[model samples]
Target: MPPCNSTSHAVGGNTWELAVVWGVLYSDSAVVWGVLYSDSAVVWGVLYSDSAVVWGVLYSDSAVVWGVLYSDSAVVWGVLYSDSAI
Candidate 1:
């Protein structure tokens, strides 16, 4: 996982044949919400705060059931998904 500041939160997953799901939160940013799914696991939602970033798997199956917020230069507030096996 990458390094995050005190105001930032990050979630990461390392798996060989599974999927991961999670949430993230960031301060001083907009609000975001979404739903994601994986072949190995199911994620209903994720919430985050305080300059947090949402990161997902590179090759995981996913579906967006709602809205999502993302920004490279600004803080983000919402759910996050990552790698998982179950």
Candidate 2:
């Protein structure tokens, strides 16, 4: 197991926010995951797989997803799935 590093800072007007500025790598396969938030809502998230699959999501009033599958297929939607056919 590896140690996880995290930090928090004041955003403004006494509002403190904790943000993961970097992705946490788990195990030896090098899979990385990260998320960012603002005003109590998720701003964006990312997932990187060892097999060259990259997934990402963005939220702004509604959910939106943009991803690239292991087969190099591109997809866009309000939801995401690990299946390449999605």
Total clashing pairs for each candidate: 17, 0
Winner by lDDT: 2
* Residue-wise C-alpha lDDT for candidate 2, range 1-86, written one tens digit per residue: 23344455565656555543333435456565555444333344445555445555544423433443332345332443333343
Residue range 21-83, candidate 1, lDDT tens digits: 343434454544433333343344444433345432232235433435554445554544444
TM-score of every model versus the real structure: 0.20, 0.32
Q: How many backbone clashes does candidate 1 have?
A: 17
Among these predicted structures, which one has the highest TM-score? 2
Native RMSD of candidate 1 (Å): 13.2
RMSD to native for every prediction? Answer: 13.2, 8.3
